[model samples]
Target chain A: MKKLAILFMMVGILIVFPGVLQGQASLKELTLSERTIQDPMKSWTITFTQPINKGTLKKQNFLIKDDKKRQVKAKLSLSKDEKKVTITPESPYKKGVTYYLYIKGNVKSGSNAFLNEHTVLPFKIGAVPKESKNSSGKTTTNDKQPASSSGKTASSGSDSKSSSNASTSTSSKTPGKNLVKVQTKKHSHFDEISVQVSDYVTKVKAGSNEFEYKGNNLFVLYQPGLKSGEKITVKGYSMSGKVLETKEVVIP
Target chain B: MKKLKGIGVAFILLLSILMPALNQSVSAAAAPRIDHTSPAANEQNVPIDTDIRIYFNSDIRGISSQYIKLFEKSNGTYYDFPIKTVKKDGEALHILPEKSLGFNKEYMVQFNGPAVDLLNGTYNQHLSYTFQTNYIDFYELMVVNEGRLMNMLDTYAPRQIKAFAPKRYINEISVIHKKTGSLKGDQASFNGITNIDINTKSEDVVNVHVDIMKDGKSLQKGYASKVTGTKASKNQFTFDIGFSNIPDFYDVRVTVLNNAQQTIDSKIIKFAAEDGKAITSFKESYKYKTAGNGYTFHELLSKESLFADLLAESMMQDIKVQVEDR
Candidate 1:
């Protein structure tokens, strides 16, 4: 009995010791969505909700890689609040390509707790297809077919039918992909918003095809076939995309 | 020991979180200040034509519309000229006067505060300068004249003449004199004689006489009463002399008389009408040069006469008359 108890104690020590020494390093709930961008090529802002501890936060590590594992490197910088880090890819990512984000040990929580040291979070980047091909190897319908107009069938042909089904499933799985999330304070003069996806933010001028945001209320000057709660990505730098106030908008 | 390790890890994280915040505060405090304006403050005696410009130590972003104002001291009126409308040469404000200021008048330029640097949002204090307009000392008068005259040999002829004369003086010009031969030898005998004997083509003898011949064929004829007084101003004159049927060549003598009836000047002028054949031949040659082929005789003669008259008038008007300048 004494031997058994001693063995049990040793086993407990081994398990608990590793736990304590390893430190509670974990990625907080990571929120992902397309950031509103105006200029997609030059620069973009990707916002995270969780505040990072600047001291323990190591350099943000990310890679843009294709399905074939061809890797493209990216640079990252922490905002003043350390709650957000903007990832600028060394080269612009290809449209319609899936990319994986491997954040290394450097990222930390507001309490200076390191996030997942080895695990990488993966996400895909793609643009809304202006047009799709048909199985007949001929273009049945040009890109001029409006996406949401006339309630026409989303699928033009067999291949388009598959593509449409896939896009619909992907969007439904990630509801955030269709939301331009902006956080505003009640009656406050300004608010600091965050961008999470790599996209553009553009202002549709008044009397043009753009919408206006009046104190967090969005209104379209001209109808762009957009329903309520649709997503739009604006691109430009306002205080380095950490704090931007825009009044004009457009349906993406 | 496990708890201690956990605490160590937490402490490291905490330090990492606070590092960036600490660095930002330091940089914000080290931002530079505006040193001085390019045009020094309270500068005076600037030229009226000078464009006012200002410079700061650092690159600026905003220039307020209300910052620049011009004031008229005489009327105590002030007006604002927006910076955008004001031309910019580098950092300078190009202020153009709507109307030039009167000579030796005092004016003021005021630069108001709130011309803030765009990057830093720092405002400048109100600065004013008083300047006086210097006398430009340029006065000019341009005179243009168009008229006619009769002299043919006068090469100084012009259809138009422009003259510059001092406004302070009254210019005086004497009448032009026509050249003529003096009475000598056979002509001397008729110098003082008022009456001359003339033979006409009809063989009738008539007396050709005149009071005086001023020059060439400008004859003073008839009774002193018949000679109308010079009707134009002292600056101009016109006269008419009459003659009856006379020989081809004739001499007329005249004596000049003052209002007191005393002789003051006397002279005799001779005129000749060549034979009909000679006169016709000369006329034909003149016609060929001026009116042959495509030309019309009447038009050519009129044009030539008009040109000669215009040339002579221009010469007379352009002749320098002595005048005083102050």
Candidate 2:
């Protein structure tokens, strides 16, 4: 195990900073002509690295949410070659509001390779005023704030804190911008479990206790001493030492 | 909670000790025995050519084959025959005799002595069985110079050529006999086929052509030759056609023509060139398949020899299967 612990640490580091290993271009991308929450929501185009199967492109894979995490309905369609997909919102974008568009990594390419990474795109419907940033061009709090001066759309600070607390419970459930989804698989000969890091985690729990990091996944020698059907739970830690997420895996 | 834990530990400990003792007693008491056998013991009319299967209650040690013997009882004597085993699992054996048994013959097999089982226990018992075969009587062209046929092929050929030249292909005989000195040809060991393609319009009028081909080229051919029998002139239907000189080895195509010179039928007869092993597959196909042509010859076989032949084949096949599986 000392080597195994080093392996887990490497996996945790890789999960936290994936773009450092693979180029950003390797991931599927979504293109937006305009990001401002102005009005009259139009369509957004999503392109995959490889041609995808049309049947696997489900609307559920595209989750459009508001700041409160409330889902917005949308229609998704794939092109004939299935390389490109278009997602159209049923309702127009509300001005001064930010929407979060989350696409899952489970979408399959025609040849069966999955998109394998979830992407989150956060954009507003309206543009910021020209003078929102300081002359030094550093993005200060002012630039980060919603551009809309309209008070009706600005969320209350209390509600934001409450939503943040609610989100902490199942932090790494989805493939977030910073979190890599831990998908564990077992075979007759080997058992592998990926120790995923959520957005907040800078390290993963994958050392000692018979756990060793092998690249992106942690492998237990065959299996844990857990009885049949027992599950092993692991926790991901944030840079500040807070628990970001807890994951459980079982082996036969 | 603590009391329940203690009880659980005690229960597991009890099982660990009792289970092994119980298993040992049961295993020691049981003996390896045959659960069932193909052609069933004392079976009659068994196919002249087939494999034998023996299923045992317990696995037999592979070395136990030395304790088994399969032979034919001809004239109250035993003759060793060719056998090939296919599958020999610890609990099962498949025997395939390399040749077909003569029709209406008796075959015998005995499993003697320390037949060991998986548990290292010896089954010190003797088991024997006899079975009869019923098939279209098939006859072989025998070259009997008081049993040893003269070798005409090469140095490997039987050393007694002059010993059997006078009665070459004259006397028809069974595929096997208890006589130890018989130097039968490899082809003679096979039960002559009730081949569908070998009919003659009239034994004397038909023109039979025997062509010996090597690598698809006819090395030799014989036509309008005289091949006489023991008492009567050899008919076209049952004569062994010979090349001018016995060359190296086997497949010969026999083509028959009607008196008008019209081609009637033909067949390729394959024989093993060495070891006295018969071409079992050829005989088996003939035995199992329906003869498409209207032709047959009557002959008799010893049931005892045929049974032993079948048992030997199955046992041999079983061993082969075991080797392959291993």
Candidate 3:
């Protein structure tokens, strides 16, 4: 009986020790650039020190979860050099919410070497405030209403205070300037808003209704009952919930 | 008041967090110069309420109304226009007018001296630009390739210009030739031909003129054609334009002209190279070729083994002949 127990113990040790060794190897964390993001429309660009295997860029390897631990739907795109991966949320992240970007140990490098680290990067959106205040002291909240003619009241949140926020945020932006081109085309019964926005823009708002970025240089929004010669204001926001640009376009 | 204070604190905190990123991107050390302008020089059909913007190559201190002036031309005289705001945002200057500009009127902007630059002392270059406000709005102005070929060139190929106006205000279509991209060999000797088809739906006749522009100056002379005006929609008129090669990239500007000879709609169409061919097919055009001369050590050894086998076979035959003679 003692000899049999010794044999079982030896077998158990051989089975469990490799797993412990692997768990220790994968505990390594990668340093991130920005920990707190203000823009709800922000996309995270995570660059790896070594080239990644394209086949390993699967949902099991890359994931983003909100504070509720629910997986947030995001798009993973590998850079041409295979050393950078961009994580873009399908929808805007909720304000004042914390999200964790997880890179699993299953992810492999180009040389077939495992990352060996269950990397978790925690980032917060919109700082500590759940609601932002405008100049009139009215707390601004994200309006979840569908775009329509009756949605005018929802746009009041983007008043002078938000414009001031846009100006301040844009002043601190580095590198160069961002040009937002807005063109309003008057149709028979509706006005089509066509804007040329850069990749950095997370949301494009016309009047009060928000338009999805759609991962393109240009996006369009339709407003009903809009007349020719009428003017409309367009705004673009970054991932940090900060307004990057505001432009007034006339319907033509 | 408390909300404002909270916002101020948040703004300061955000600025503090973004300061490191801001410092890393700004590496300019040169004097600020005019990179470009919104209503470019001689640009036509500008929106009446369009904000006049001046983008700079580097950062500027601020925008000054004293250095920037706007004027409206009426009755052969220029009148000073009121500027409501002059703001320096980032690396650009934003100018807003008190009210919307007059329609179908010419406006001139003058940029005088003493704009403070971030690095250098001041940028005092005197520059002036002029633009004409649009009269009518065009719903769509498209340049379509009618030939169905990917890269069409010369007079045999017919391209179409479709203009959809809200009203019947379009009078004519103007084709302005502009050179782009690098040339193959000699810029002065290279040439090509292209045909344009104007498709309009106006009650008035629309004329077509191909004007050649050199070094930003209009030559004012080229091919011209007159087409019958039809009250019906989708009328087509085709004309040919012959041109010489200047640069590598080729683009032509098609404009819709009003009764006052002012451009109401304009579109720039870039010609694509067919089957990965060079943009300009000049006499001295060159093609790219890729060659591989790399071999692995195993391949080199295999090649050497074949030579060694041949030498050994020859030596064996000589030994066999010597043995037979013995």
Candidate 4:
């Protein structure tokens, strides 16, 4: 009985051996982090499924083509784990341009396996993508940031109200402005006031010291000697310099 | 005869000068008279812990403490009491008892002997200032005194000066908080008005000069005299200085001075952006002095109404805004 059982196990091993060898004969595929790189590409990377052999790794032959399909020079280097390939542009990418990147499957891995297929990647530099379309007509792919503008943007159309938030990571909306106490500080001759706001103040014209500022939710002003009510106007602006709201105050 | 007439005219001139000299000699011999007293003569309802001070016309060179004694009178008997100090002989005398005096009791700063000054000027007579020590008076801020000064205007709270209100010395000084752009739905309590209370305990320093300073620049200077002859003992020398028109954002300091006009205390009342070229000193041109009734800070606010507009124009500079990119 023991000899018969040994004979069956041997047959099972023989049947599975060819399957394992056939699987090892095929090569694993390579992937990229981002297929469509954004405009003004600083670098591009290719990742492998297994560790790569530094001695056997192909140093050159990676190609990048401009929109006209003209070849551009680029440098390629492997990551520390030998699983990543980084392509650095020797020169800066042109504005409003597109490029094509490719590497052949002849690249070998530590296991001596070749890439399953030729790698191809398409990227854009300071240009709109072929797959994406923008119809809002307010902002374009060209100008994401603009200079500060003045006066009201008289667009009362019921368009989607996109609130412009503060730009800084440390910046925060002045919460509870609706419940802020109109606190007053008294000096020898004048009073200092702290007024909370619902939004950020883009321009403050308190008394004669009118200027632009950032990250201010507390509106303060000096009432020189003291009299009946005065008018205070505060204009709220988006980071893009679009006036969102205007506030006026009457203090008696 | 004409020569004699000339001599007579010269003699007359000589006599005129001689008469003034004689009068000066006589006046110099007389005792120094009290020009100002902290507690006016025969003043009633003074704080029990009040410090007694007397200012004289001439400086007494050798006047000893023995000559100036504090006497507390009880029934028909009087007992000598210890005092703080006798400064400059007879120029000024400050008497601070170790503790408060008995309420409703009379006290006297008695001159035991003839008080004399330098240059043989004598204070010829025995003098004593008899005053009754009572409770200190609580000075109230007349914010809404029957339509006289109504700032709160039907608010939840009255604009009354507290016992700890900041002491404002200047008459008619108004502290105006620039309009807070608070919307109508803001249910939060808004106290844009500054209620300054000055605690005037007669037991401590008497009259003080309060200097309102922005940054290091003096914006206003005024004197705070201790309240006396009032029935209440909870008196605080307070000024509800309406913030009229200070430009937004300032480093405000309220300084307190002792009777000697030296800064005894200072506190930062408001903090804001410091002006490098701010008005270093409040223009003395706008100072208002009340002749009879004590000049109040509100009076000054009303006197220069145009200042509010100027300050409103200036406060226009203090709006600070923060915006973010969405």
Candidate 5:
């Protein structure tokens, strides 16, 4: 019975061996300079095992796609020897997004040999360290703070009188508990403000400028060409881009 | 008769000079008199923390604490203010109150008789002066640093003094961030504003002067034009001080000059542009003399300062490349 089982296993190995070799022969390994990018402005370098055909180095032969399957506009440059290709995005890639570099199978080497298999190389920009799944099966994070821009932009259209009253009323209560407080130091040509953020605030935005949350809850903002009595709108944001607090302070 | 007349004329001239000297000596030996007093008699809008300074014509010792008293008026009643300490510095008698005076209140300082001079000449005059405290203190010195350079200098978080590592081109960004356009024209290393809030409106002009110091030595001085007391509520005076291109530790002396160009309210702020070192010298600036340094920095090179240095270095490199290309 043991000899019969050994015979069946040998036959099974023989049946799978050719198919495994065929699968290996069809799949092409993609080569990339980096698999992960920390900078949104990072460029990828693709090296060919054999010298590539110069004519085959067309934009159509090489494609970069974001996670949404949308093609990213990129500029491609080939080395003089045609063995190295560099792909740089025209604009910065969004952080925490995955991108795929597709090299078409039609790409031919100098010897007129086809690449035989389409190669897809995946790279990620700014990886999110802690990720969890929500009820919708979508990846979500409560740990990582969103970048600066998502904080609510200050409304510039508020009535000066009402806003000034609002600001003046809140100015004295600036250092209250669990609240973001901003103190502005006004100059003739410029104004400097120090913001004391709440414990949960991750970023502070003053007018058009944005600053990361300090560990010590202090953020200083300096704006030039602001005369005294001018208004500056400061906003604090949480990790999920929620406006934690907003203070419209007149320059003093 | 001619000789006698000549002698009489000479004697008269001699006596004219002698008589004045004799009177001066007599007065000098008399009671101790106050030559000047800060927050002079009936002075309005005085700082709450102002020392009750009585400048004497001659050096005087500290009189009895009971004789030198401060009274604050409330509801038509004068209450004795708590005395912390009384100091006699050379020709000045400084009376420090235990607690800061209330805002917009009238206070009277009394030197009730027997103000003994250094030579023990006692003045029996009961001298007193009244001054009303200001509603808002104008000595708030706010140093404003801005632009890409400041952004680079402040890496981790924003702070009062933009500090940098010494000799690093990155640190200069903190001081010269206000310089826009070309580096050719007049550019200030640091720009600051001090508010002078007073109740009374006057045409008195306040001239501002900035003296830059390095290692305790005077490096250079920049002058700001006189800003006349324009409003009764607040007067914002700006100081545009130019620092040398060298990156090092510096002490910036910002002085508010009176009409006579004498230093009135002054502050000395220590700045560090070396080794990402933090500065502690800013506290020396008179807080009672002015408002405290706005938004004092605990550390110049926090995680934020590092961020500033890196950002500034990258930005400066880009600027340098752009300039070279131009």
Candidate 6:
């Protein structure tokens, strides 16, 4: 009877030892929050619950895939402390795009154990504003304002007024008052019609059909010909486009 | 008792016999023997003009003719110099330099492994040695920074110096100043100058001067200065000034004559200054934003901006590009 008892005890010890040793070898646990797609042009930091082992991380190991399992622009970088892995897209993540994050092969836990095989974290990107297209086939009006060319109609005039109001609301939120204000001025000289785009009125070349625009102190030029006193809409694209400004110009 | 005694005796004999063999094996693995070298190892400071020669005892196989490398210490960075090898006297390996080494600088020659002995199939260990070149007589002066200038000897002048300034700043560099009586037109001059400006709208300008002299006589001089151009929309400018006709035997000196000088500020830079090169110029468009996660596009932009600013300030004869993390 004593021998049987001893045999049972030995079996239990053998089974439990491996488990204890494995537990000790475990380095740390890592938890990833739901993935998010913010600004693509800007870098986004993905926070992790715990630091991960960076030694096992390689460029090709982590991947981002669309719903069809097709690969998209993706890059993985490990933090200095080996705590977090920051994934970045080569381009901005398109709004309203869904993607899956897959952690594979080279990814390892802090204890140097391989991460779960085929580990995948899926998430959807937010909706982005679609580019507006002109269905009328006459002239396409951009997100800036009503078609600057079709300013003769009352409907167009009312559209310009609403856009101008929107531009004012956007400009008030701008950080600095000295910020260059962009205005679109339309001109027409018979067959040659040109629009002048300038950040400030001072930088505009009067009657020359050439105008310059400024943002972040950078200057850009636009040349379009239109008649004098013609109602034209000017719109501004800020770094964030949050401070878009549109103004009416009378070409002299 | 008898069996136990026999076992003990056998164990002792085994240990004694294996001990010497183990010791020999460990020593052989730990320290490799130096067979022979071309110019020979532990050779005293040799001439900088001479090609490096090293010969090993074993016939080396699978050794790449281009495996040898030369490194120079610069600003805490190891800059690699290309080395060429020639087969001489049948078995000896000779490394020749495409260009003479800088004087008074410590250089290291390294042989990458895969240098194998043809006879025994044993690999030759990686080999390296450090040595200094003989000093040249004249000093070379260059502008490394707006406020900081490098004073160097002709034998030890750096291949290049990096500078930073606004896009619109005018850069003027003169190896030997024609305006100063110290340097004659016929005499060799190492004096140079560079000027540059990047902020044309702001009208920001950076002017600097570099000079080398000995006993009140200028050996090398350089000057650079720039002003805003006709295009108010364009704000950046770069220049490269070369120091030619450097005379032998002179001390080096460098000074920031003017951080920003214009015609209105004619007396901005001091008349006399000190020390030092090849002129190379580069330019790149600037972008402001972060490109991706764990990566800041700002750094790339800064590097591009710095390179463009430097290239505009110097005359670079040649440039080599190496891509990493691609």
What are the lDDT scores of the predictions, listed in order?
Answer: 0.33, 0.43, 0.48, 0.43, 0.49, 0.37
Order the candidate numbers by TM-score, best to worst: 5, 4, 2, 3, 6, 1
Which candidate has the highest DockQ of all?
4
Per-residue lDDT value at B242 in model 2:
28
Give candidate 5's whole-model lDDT: 0.49
Arrange candidates by lDDT, highest first: which order?
Answer: 5, 3, 4, 2, 6, 1
Query: Which parts of model 5 are misplaced by more than 4 Å?
Result: A1-203, A206-236, A239-252, B1-31, B118-120, B137-326
By TM-score, the best candidate is 5
C-alpha positional error of residue A194 in candidate 4 after TM-score superposition, expressed in Å: 7.5
Q: How would you class the docking of model 1? A: incorrect
Off by over 4 Å in 4: A1-205, A208-230, A234-246, B1-39, B42-66, B69-110, B117-326
Q: In candidate 5, what are the lDDT values of residues B1-326, reduced to their tens digit?
A: 99999999999999998999998899767656677887688876454545678778777754666677889999888899888988888888888899776656899888775654455366568877788864321112123223533443344233422222111110011132111011121221121122211121122335566665544566567774433454222433333334322222344556555577754344343342211111111111111111111111233234443333332222111111000000
Candidate 5 accuracy as TM-score: 0.29
CAPRI category for model 5: incorrect
For each candidate, what's the DockQ?
0.00, 0.00, 0.00, 0.04, 0.02, 0.00
Q: Estimate the overall C-alpha local distance difference test score of candidate 3.
A: 0.48
DockQ of 4: 0.04
Tens-digit per-residue lDDT, A34-89, candidate 4: 12233354665555444555764554435677889887787778778875566777
TM-score of chain A of 4: 0.36
lDDT of 1 by residue, B208-304 (tens): 2253222224333573222225543343222223332122222334333444554332323232222111110000000112110111112323465
Tell me each candidate's i-RMS in Å. 54.9, 41.6, 28.3, 20.1, 24.3, 32.1
Quality class of the docking in candidate 2, CAPRI style: incorrect
lDDT of 5 by residue, A1-252 (tens): 999999999888878786754632564443321244456766665555445678878888777899999999999898786766777789888866878777765566666655544555566664423343333446544333211110000111223211000000000111112234677775533455778754344456765565422234555655555667788777665433555456678976
Give per-residue CA lDDT, model 1, range A134-211, as digits (tens): 323343222111111000001122231111100000111111121244332211111112222112221222222222
Which residues of candidate 2, in runs, are more than 4 Å off? Answer: A1-252, B1-23, B119-122, B136-326
Give the lDDT of residue B68 in candidate 5.
75
Worst 10 residues of 6 chain B by lDDT: B317-326
Clash count (model 4, backbone only)? 61
